[model samples]
Target: MSAANLYLERPALTPAAEDLREEVRTFIAEQRDSGALPPPERIGLGFDVDMTQRIADRGWIGLTWPRQYGGQERSALERYVMNEELLAASVPVGAHWVADRQSGPVLLKFGTEEQKRFYLPQIASGNCYFCIGMSEPESGSDLASLKTRADRVAGGWRINGRKIWTTNAHRVHYMIALARTSPAEGARHAGISQLIIDLKAPGVTVTPIISMAGEHDFNEVLLEDVLVPDEALIGTEGNGWNQVSAELAYERSGPERWLSSFRLISELVDVLGADTQPSTQEELGRLISHLLALRQLSLAVAGMIEQGKSPNIEASIVKDLGTKFEQEAVRVARNIASAEDLVGNGRAPRLRALLMHAQQYAPAFTIRGGTNEILRGIIARGIGLR
Candidate 1:
């Protein structure tokens, strides 16, 4: 494909998606009013079991999957609207985020019938949570260099490896892990496979890795000869690299990439009030402009997924730009507010709190999922510049 072909086709939200926006907004408001969800400032990673189940009961968890798997079989555009509303409202969606976002899709595409029947419905029901097992101790962004290995056994495979920076590993019931099943042949990407490992299986250990903000979301998961049935394999053996690459489009292209600090932006606006300075307004306008453009790009990616197209290059571009914008939003918020006044007893205490949280969390925005440097490299290759 030529560089010109890399351009994403414009996507427009349908009327159904527009209606879903209001429905999701109303649900979020009800959750907030009932105190089931935390305030934006206090919503760290936003994981709430009760809240996830509530969303599931509304048939919103697996929005784009087949109805046989308990999904509503809605369009990806509708899922996009629902996701944006939840994140913008700072709803606690972390519990089912990964499963709903990628795992379910992966299973539907590549899993055996038994695997699909066993896992998809549970995931759609919000009773199951999953974490990604791609990052390892020495192989953070260089996933091909990962040393985690799985050896073939009589009835299954015995896995022995440690995964780091795994979000919610301790709280999740299962993990879709990528491990080396065979030695690298000609390329490093070869000889790898994905497995559906039960986190509570014997010899599995999960230890929390607290963040700089003192949050316990990240985890270190160790698999010590953990055995899984042959049915645990996601697809064919020695195809994990391809499977994971395909999944990255889902992982990277989303409203979450840009909306992580939206709470801070909203709070900043509230603090600035009606009679704000021109300079502040200019900065806010610039931020909003970038956000609008990013949203369009992300929506285009969603449309591509709905059409069964893999927009990996576009997804990488979105992630690279979105994360940079999130980090910049934190800086702008900090410059607009005084630290002393922010920490002091003020009318905008919640805004101050959110600003502080954003600052501490800003560094990880570019690092998680994939680093900004890695994303740029992918974009360079995609554009035929590399």
Candidate 2:
């Protein structure tokens, strides 16, 4: 197929990424003019159910999901364009972000027929949301050391463990949990399994972890003998390590990685016009360079995903670099301003809120979705240095 045809034809390879961008931009403009969406906040606390429902109503949530699953069967590039525009506008997209990003794709690729049929459509329709269940108290970055255990039962399995730092745990419907299905034997990574645990299950408990920004985003989930049916097992029983690794690439390379500070970038440009100071000018230039570089790297990974290749290392690099840039953008913005935004003095309340919010959440940009150290390890291994 021609490049345009190839891109236009599939959700993963939309030939019309540019056109899609404009369309999304127009939608964001309309939303802004209607006062339906808040001004850009640079923070990633973009969760508005009504706004999410609006996106879903417009069929943007599952741009790349299969039609049978309620998606429009768009290409990855199309979805990429849509995602960039939404995050740029700081749209409240937290509800369906995780499901649309990776969980939906993972299920489509590795789940059983029953699993796909039940969950995929709901996800595409914005009815089902998912959070990750990877880190535990004892195991934060070293996922191989996670202690969340899953004992086998006749009909299914009984899960018992605590998952910390689960984003939107209280609102999400499900979690893709990594647990020990069996002992790892001699291999540290063996016998692990991914279970699709219903958050509303009888023994499940979610406790909020209010962030420094005073937002209730992260939570600690306790799973006590939660029964997961055979259908809840994603992929093979012992291949979760590899499966979740692939999913990380999808999580790490999306527009959200770079767009978190986009609001701040915009404000910096608007407020600090032609006569910016030397230090402020230097910082802005650096942020732009890093943003563009991360974009190129992330776009390359998106191309790989469109072409059915897993670009885990590239994803990690983009995630690490993009996250750092996002944090730096906040710091630069905070420093450049006269510190009035801190108390909403000269700055708009929305901008002040977002700025203060970004200050608090900046630490999480590197911490969440895997740490900087872990990503560097992945990149180093990719280049044969590790």
Backbone clashes, each candidate: 0, 14
1-386: candidate 1 lDDT, tens digit per residue:
23544877877889999999989988988887888865677535578898899999999999888888888989999999999999888887899999999999899988999998999999999999999999999998899999889999999999999999999999989999999999887899999999999999998999999999779999999999999999999998999999998888889999999998888888777767677667777787998999999998899888988888888888998999999999998887777665324445566778877877778888998999999999989988887777
lDDT of 2 by residue, 1-386 (tens): 23311121222434588888888888889998999986665477566778878888888977887788788887887787788778877788999988888888889888988888899888877788999999998999899888888998998999999999899999989999999999878998999999999999999999999988777888999999899887789999989999988888888888788887798778667766687567767777887888877776666667778878776776777788888888888887787675323334464556566678788878888988899998988877776675
Q: For candidate 2, what is the TM-score? A: 0.91
Off by over 4 Å in 2: 1-15, 40-42, 339-350
Global lDDT of each candidate: 0.88, 0.82
TM-score each candidate.
0.96, 0.91
Evaluated against the true structure, the overall lDDT of model 1 is 0.88
**CA error at residue 270 for candidate 2, angstroms:** 2.1
Question: Which runs of model 1 end up more than 4 angstroms from their true locations?
Answer: 1-5, 339-345
